[model samples]
Target chain A: MYHDNYEEDDLAAEVELVTSAQYPQDADVDDGFDSEGVVSSQKQPIAVEIPDTIKNFITYFHRNVLENNIYELHTLYEVTFNKLTDRFYAKQPWPEAELISPLVDDDQVFLTLYRELYYRHIYARLSPSIQDRFHSYENYCDLFNYILNSDFPVNLELPNQWLWDIIDEFIYQFQSFCNCRNRIKNRSEEEIALLRDNPQIWSCYSVLNVLYSLIQKSRINEQLLVNKNGGDMLEAAGEYGSRPLYKMLGYFSIIGLLRVHCLLGDYTLALKMMDNIELNKKALFSRVIPCHVTTYYYVGFSYLMMRRYADAIRAFSTVLTFIQRTKQYHTRSYQFDQIAKKCDQMYALLAMCIALCPTRLDENIHNHLREKYGDQLAKMQKGEDSISVYEDLFQYACPKFISPNGPNFDDPASLSQVNEPYQHHAKIFLSDIHNQTMIPTLRSFLKLYTTMSIDKLAAFLEMDADELRTQLLMFKQRSRQQKWITGNLLEGDIVSTSDLDFCIKQDMIHIAESKVGRRYGDWFLRNITRFQDVIATLEHKN
Target chain B: MAQLAMNRPEVIQSLIDGVDRYNPDNISILEEYLATQCQNEEYDLMANLAALKLYQFNPHLTNDRVIINILAKALTAVPAPDFNLCLYLLTEPMIIDESIKQLTALHQLLEQSRYAKFWETYKSDSAYEQLVSEVRGFSRAIRSIVARVVSMTHQQIASSLLESYLDLSGDDFAAFVKEQNWELKGAIVQIPVNKDNEAKTVVIRENIKFEQLTKVIGYSNEM
Candidate 1:
């Protein structure tokens, strides 16, 4: 007989009983915590109990954070820290027994974040040097113990739910904190004595270990879409029916962290992480649709950054190939067509990233791009300017691709009627993504031109550099209108001419789609098609 | 030597029987084995060689000189079976459901297949004629009264399944009418509803307008 009447209250009590019993080494298997050296299975009950006072304090803290009221956050943190100290009284029954069970890393990490936040808030008045000296987890825990042994006035009963909620926030926040910390710590290191020294070799030893730790989770699959009984994903990571999106987010977050590590000259570690990403891509690509063009772009960019241009070319080419292979749904309206065109331009920009591969790359790399990409490569070679090839490709391809309305599966007159307005709208939208999104990307690429040894080529792109800058500046000035436009950032046009901005935007969009199963293909097709028409219109003006 | 001679016929028969005993599952396993075999460079080279020998008379089967030229040109990139498999799944007719879905799939496959050099032969005018003939074969089974009730396009004839047409026949014409009730034909592709009218008269034009054909058949609306 399957039990259908499982209550949250009962589960809370179950968690408490388990926690008091001194967790078996494998109790972590339930939390599905593997990467942080914690393993727990669903069979093991986690008895996590927080007294009532602590629960109210955390609830207030969350409410305040959501409402952006800092004063409440300050009050909650102050009260919780005081309660935390009192909970560790000298005569406490569990004080003699290690307060932390070895298997409970998830809980420990959660508590660590909580303590970190508390310490950061309380020590804000201290000097920066003083803050740094006492920032270690051991030191922070010691502070808590010191406060507990002392006469700390505390009246609090932590709620059963408080610990879980705090744990969730901690998991989310710590990733970002670790990423920033890695970058800052690495920047202080001195440059190597020799150029001939293999940075990759050095990086591998230093960075790879951390990168592996990040994406060590399982592959994301489609089961993630199911929302069975509101059991959270991290708690149910090993479950067969876990939603692919959450797992995917976890993977991406790790990748993003690894990317930061790479930027900090931890390339060896980043490369290791990328390998895991590549190996798991089949699962990722199959479940994911449309915008993996960005994934390819990043992998390629990472290679390009490390002077592994040949590999970079392969990645960029793959992005372009996948884009080209995709078929747009048939729609009569030009409006729908614009969306398709926008998609094409995005892909084209991705292609352009490889097309403009820095001349500093070895002879083998130059030949590889030329041989692999062919026409796109030829276009890159025809002009020394990075942005010019992009400009030409966008202007040439846009008219052919963009559309406004979703495709009408049937009807001649109806499809046409539906198309006209959408086409017009799409053109405007695409033109905006171009003026706003692509131009800034070109500007950033223009700056990279100086880094290349090829002066003549760099200068060529520089001639039109100001025009590109002006165009982006105009776009940047426009206010954000759509809900998707965070801080007025245009999605696709965010990358530079030499950089794969469209790919980035595409990946970002793919991420959005994967997270929420709302299909944007119809709108995408319309928008891209309209973009093409706008390009055609511009060509006529020119 | 004398003992081998006596058992040779039995040995050959045993080998034949062994192959004959292969079931569908056995064939599947063999197919996988063969695929992996053909993937080997030596096996591929031998295959080319075998075809080359056969091509001595039938150049159409395998022209060595042309094969060499093609191989030389294709040396840079190997054909990706995964990519081809994706294409197959995307265009395969085995997945067709409703009449509308079948028709859409048919048009899509035909149009895209026309662009590929590999698939260009399938898009010839004769291919269209064959499809038309197949449709005519299906239409022959319909009675005069029902034939009068329906108008068919050449593209439709090639695409519409015999079973689907049969489903519309006899007393089941009511179901057919219900299915068509959702189908919108000229000017717009949308359903039109009229209350309290069971046997609503539908005009079946013998000749579909050019624009309607283009909208539905020729160039993709999205393209």
Candidate 2:
């Protein structure tokens, strides 16, 4: 059956070619050639033999530009455009001029838009030196103007459904690009004024608004919510999977919603959206796209902001595990290498979380940390008093974790700008190690003894008695809920002030047994559970 | 007739009343029916409440994949604080009613690691006789956590102290210790220790000597 269909398709293509050759001028007027110049008269045999150069250009566009190799795409575009333009401008009459004119014009429009979008992606990944060469914001504004003024009618000869799908993806991506530009520029009043003054900007904005409204009107959000309740989650997952265009758009809508919310610092809403995506275990684990790593990364970041350390640890751990597994394959591609490097940031953030909450990293992750930040990690593990170790780890990790350049290089600002959110959180985590863990542990360690002279306790803690007393008094006042310590800090013996009286009076510290100590133990246990859940979720591919 | 309109408060009240009736089958049916109705009407809070009530009535239902689907939906439908009551249902199942003073006290006691006080208060609550099995299971989990915490510091504790902590009698305490494969020395019970062999032996000796010296010094200072 398939062979018969192939034969029929071949015959149709031959007949179409013969007809076009016999009446070339009539063919152009009658066919109303789409942007690609494919004759829409027959659906089965759309393939026509175009020049090899044109074929190469299309292939390069698909392989490099569509595949998100913006760096390579930029180089290829420069070479291809110059080569094609030289051939077109040569003094000799070009034999393929008729065939190539429409193709060139179409390429011009496509390349212009592609270049603008490509630079936006490039701005995210390139170093400052490379970024200075490209004015992405200006290019975007130029493209926006072109799109506003251009009367390029929707080609009736094209597959409208397919075209709309592409448009849908473009709109979604453009919205995200705008969002990043807005964030990266810090939404300056001057930029806002410029956008307001430019009427072309409004046209693009109106189109995005309409597109977004259409997406909302389509009830995709409500459907996603409803799917979580009782509907088949994989239903939408399957529909999106059927076509690349739908798949990209679907994945974008789901991921973009969460990312935008997280970027905006609406962590609660982001968390809620993440919860829905997570429940559709199929959607998360689906091979339609490897969204799990990106999804989990953002989810972890949001959880960190919300102070859900256990969940955050789980999320970051999943991202680390995914990167580790991918590393084992040793693909050595630039994209994979970028992802692996970003995982280093995950490691640093994971370390911060462990320090804050006292969770143990996996032996594998521990080994990885030792391998990367050997002496620093060892000092931290050995319970060194110096804050420099943590500071070094945080500084090393802050840039990578905050604006981790993924394979897509979706957000350009991360490359040049410090991730303010993670930077702020990293500081808090560092301060918390001192305030919440270190001080609390010291006070609880002292409380293990039934009673001890202030001088002796202070001597054991390596601080002056008066200073220790002042610190303890400050801690006591700060934590009004802690009833385990109550006494005059200035003159009396330091004592276990817990109401429950027992006779074991040795002044030995057992960190895991004390009230504050037990909290640390619980935190470790919670992290273990979180790690297990992350492993389970990642492995649950159906 | 007015109730048939299925307004927000009426729907929620109906769910509450259904749960009060103790008819699991009807409650299950109403849960699904009300969920659909609420979703259609965009009464998201009520939908989440109904889902919570369903999970509460048939705690075993959560084991079903479908119930997880409902839970995910419920969590997203409302803000975290609004769903606090439902979250409590999952975490503290035995204390179904927040208004119940005794159960509330039991929760606090367990949370605070006041095991001896908890057992005393639990025994006095004759009104919760029907909840003995559920409360006992919760108590065991809490006792295990306390036991782990206590054993972290002391190798040996007096039998009476262990009994107070575990709410067990002399023979029962000994049996519990035996069941856990721990050693007992007359009036004192030894908690099992699991550590790297070489390090464990070295640390134990050092700790014993240090503790003994500290005790002697403390006595001398007092004298």
Candidate 3:
């Protein structure tokens, strides 16, 4: 009953508020926080003065930043700040940064950080105008410049959560801008001119440069290598990577690139971005749970697009298990609901993958998938007209893919078509599954035979012998995948992923299904732990 | 694994490193790189995709031979998404072109592991030959891929089926089967068991180490 609402399709579609919502450890999970943005005509100008409560809150927030009191800042940023905004500026932008600058004593560094939140709040609640999006992009440049391009690494430190969010939000806004820029039919002439003239703004090249610059400045790759192999961290760190601020930003930037490349439909390049980092409980991305989720989400999606469904299933099941085991620890997190929604989406993705390439999933995860998508799974398996089912789950699970280039401003035809890069991707994926709609049914029939003539099988399936052979070939190809064995994420050896094996001997078809051997080790270990727990309970009672 | 140097031509590398990669003039340099990639087995997917991106924007700059060669190179990088990535960059009209359609027919057959049909359809069209004519050892490369896929799934297969899949016959087929080190016994070819096609039922048993038992031993001593 508690998680039933998370299965709603519209929950995570609004990406702004979740990314904008900061996570604090001891915060309450507020449910009625989804107030849709009420567009008002009078909200354009910086004509309003700062309210006293927000003013004091800004000053206090400024002092904590100055003092580097991350504990207080965490609470203030996640809970108090959002509560205050809901109470005061519900339908409008946070009072302009220039207007609030005096409250923080004209502190440039504090204001830069403040503007990060400021623009994010606008993006979360209000409609960001052309200028707002541009200014937000500028503010990101300023923030990264302060952290990266300083003559000396600035003596500034923020929470690692904030650092990760900065990169996350920067990319989110870039995605938002690209999507917005693609639909210029309603935009005024001035806006069109601005977009045409500022082609460099929010360009894929610029965004990639920023992430790459951070990676180089911090020497994160070298640091990661030193971390993997045996070496001195200080030496591998060089200068910028020594500090936590640069190290984490550079680290987060790698995960950031993993996400960015996925958005641009470069599946191999997406996984290639993870060459330096490993995805395990001990890896650095696991230091932050959201980063951990982000890493696996894109990795699994990329593998899915590449038709490596087994690898995709592995990635999803691992993270979904992690989330399930650690659900209690983060239930009180401000991002509790967001994390739950992501879990639900992953289950949907897992359902699609398992339907296509059936594998024995973890028992708990498999149960959850059946609970969430039982109807769709059955439909997908039966496969008469189930492309819509796959498309629905795909859209519900896949990232918001972005086009790398902007609209052709000179062409009126371009303005007519809004950016739907994900649809292009969906089309590619749907056609692939279309070619294999007969696999599940054919597999069911194939399991009943050790050897049979193609003509006999075709008679059963109501198809000609030639068509059946082609189908068998397709099954053979799809069952073999390039699985990751060891080393970098991209390099892998070809392996048989399917439990079912078949071959053609002239006219007869032979099928030999591999059975998963029953294991006593896991069962014994699980019961042993339960026995120990029961004994401990009895002893404590005595 | 990534530290291994991939062969990249300096002229093409310098151009791709900058905005000059999108120049219509640089298409020739990238085409040369694709030719080199086909002659040898070397591949640089990002470089080739960048070149395709240029042609997607400037349709006039596209060379049919170059597109076909890039797709051919992508075929070798199988199980990776390089081929589909190249397909995504082509213009709508180009994607549906007669030559492109026939070439993709070959791609689909191989991709679907319809090896017999792949060879059947490939030889059915002169355009398919003309398209992949630039790539040397093209049939050999395709056969190797076919062998790689078949070797993973079967310990022994009907030699006739294997020959059909490889598009080879008689002594040529025998030599190809020998190259895989498979034993040709009458109508069957026997492949040695490796990691994948062993098809053995494994009952996993836990192997405890001395280090793990040491702590338990200490507790026993205290008791």
Candidate 4:
């Protein structure tokens, strides 16, 4: 929807012919971007100026906001605003909310929405300064306070996509703040003091409080339950939940909690957040492609960490296939690049899970995985020398883990130990891999014979029989995991995860492998469709 | 509701499954609940991890003894990734402490199913005893895990090896086998056939459900 016919090369140009046609206040004023004589007191490399077109756009945006014209806002949010961003502020921050407040008549709601995009742009393109972080946090508090605690049924409406983005970006910034807070190095004394003093800014407790409060205020859990099993919708929605604004926010907040808990390494709690919302083509999260990809990304990641490899494989495969099937529909989304990036990361994770668990995958996903991670997957399955391969895939694909607490500013010595959380997670996961390092070798040996004495197999592997026995036991235990059938993500039955199974009696080991049966359904369906096509063609010819 | 904390205590279920998990004041409640789990030999990884999670955000509330107890209980749920899940929540310095290192050594031995070595190191130093002082019957808890893994992997184990793994002997081993409904034949202990130990050939066919076929059925109406 963005026309990239702009001739302006400056990151903060005032306007271009492209956006000016709609607003017509195009004052192509570029006064060399002087850093001095800036309006706000916050020192910036580029000065903040309300370009005439954006100023005009904001006034029109204010009218649309007043009318609650979500249809207009969707085009404005998904296309016009982004096209303007690419034209004017591609490499620079948007005009500050305060700087443009006058153009919108100081309308708090519009200014709040503008600031959301303003700070989101800073986070996306430029590095957000500490003040930017704090002020953006305050702006969020203002926005949420207006919607939540306002005595009236707030006369505001938002498209579902924007609502999801609000929650998504809110958690993103919170996670960003957490990771930033963990790094206390290379910061000025003033920045450190600001961070140390205002401990509530982007605090974990406060962030979770906002998400949970959204869920509770909207009574979203009850609403979801009523939707699932028939019930009184009005009673379930209560007052706030009846409003789309509150309902969507609350629903997305559940997803926000999933991402947050996964970031905190609470994998079980991550999945626990999605108890009511089933992962399907029709879930509200699927309406936003990024949200859909994100939900599966975290769910798959949590399952991988929780040692449920089969479930992880299923989660990753389902979403990867969905993305492939629906590619044409969302390739133009504003977050398409972000979605594609997550799509690639999920492929990497799927490769790792497939190598570890040996699950059959859809042909399309399998080909993509082989294309993306063939050599690494080969090295991973080679065993014992593939530690670095696993770690590289993990680092590339895993969520950015947070340490939850900020640096102990009281002790400067501890500040240098910032890599502790990442190292901690890597160590735990690598050790888990180390336990199964002997599986490939043992599996080959097991497949060679249905019944073999443990002592004889140990001789071939040049190890003690007792040690071989231990490896076999490890295989038996590791290859069985809890899989979701029809319930909350956490509740699942313990099913055999491996294609191979074995039993040990006295000194003898017996091995068996489960193979997938030949499928006639797909072949019949394909033939039936072809036959129908032939019949239709013949009848049309007559 | 996902608050299906199933078997967990109501107070703990509410606390751990809600925003209260972030509350520093509620940690003592989880801590006390952890102590009860230890006393009853009733391990709950979710609740224990919740306690560690609270300690993670609130450094002041961290109790090394409670952490050790939690890890010790996690040692009972070995091969489930519970111990490492708890370890993930602990800071680097806390994980590398002399006490945690000693426990980790036992944990490694146990994970490798080196039951004999685990029993040896677990009993090696007085510090090991002092380290697990908070856990009421840490030895019994770990023994049950060993007993479980052994039965799952073996239909019959040499009595000497089983005794070494369990760290029980003669009459104690016999009594243990009897309690488990297992029998002691001359040189081997015969465990009852269970699902995991049976290892029958299973053909995992595709489970195509009626709902998945509804679309195909719709095409039949067109026909």
On lDDT, the leading prediction is 4
DockQ, candidate no. 4: 0.63
Better of 1 and 3 by lDDT: 3
A381-500 per-residue lDDT for model 2 (tens digits):
445763777777667654322211111123344334433334444543454344333443554455476445556777877888545533443333222211112221111121222212
What lDDT score belongs to each candidate, Candidate 1 first? 0.31, 0.43, 0.76, 0.81
TM-score per candidate, chains pooled: 0.23, 0.41, 0.85, 0.91
Proportion of true contacts reproduced by candidate 2: 0.00
Q: Candidates' DockQ values? A: 0.01, 0.02, 0.27, 0.63
Clashing residue pairs, backbone N/CA/C < 3 A, model 2 = A124-A412
**Tens digit per residue, CA lDDT, model 4, A438-528:** 8877887887788889999999999998798788878887777878898888878777788887888889998877777877776776677
Question: When only chain A is evaluated, what TM-score does every model earn?
Answer: 0.26, 0.50, 0.90, 0.90
- Full-model lDDT, candidate 1: 0.31
* Candidate order, DockQ descending: 4, 3, 2, 1
Question: Which window of ten consecutive residues has the lowest lDDT sum in model 4 chain A?
Answer: A28-37
Calculate candidate 1's fnat. 0.00
lDDT of 1 by residue, A392-504 (tens): 55454322211111222233343233223223323322322232333334434434432222233235545453243223223222211111112111111211112211111
Tell me the deviation in Å of residue A332 in model 4: 1.2
Q: Which is the winner by DockQ between candidate 1 and candidate 3? A: 3
For model 2, the stretches where C-alpha displacement exceeds 4 angstroms are A1-55, A59-101, A104-117, A120-229, A232-244, A279-281, A285-290, A328-334, A378-392, A399-434, A437-459, A463-542, B1-223
Point out the higher-scoring one by lDDT: 1 or 2: 2
TM-score of model number 4, chain B: 0.89
CAPRI-wise, candidate 4 is medium
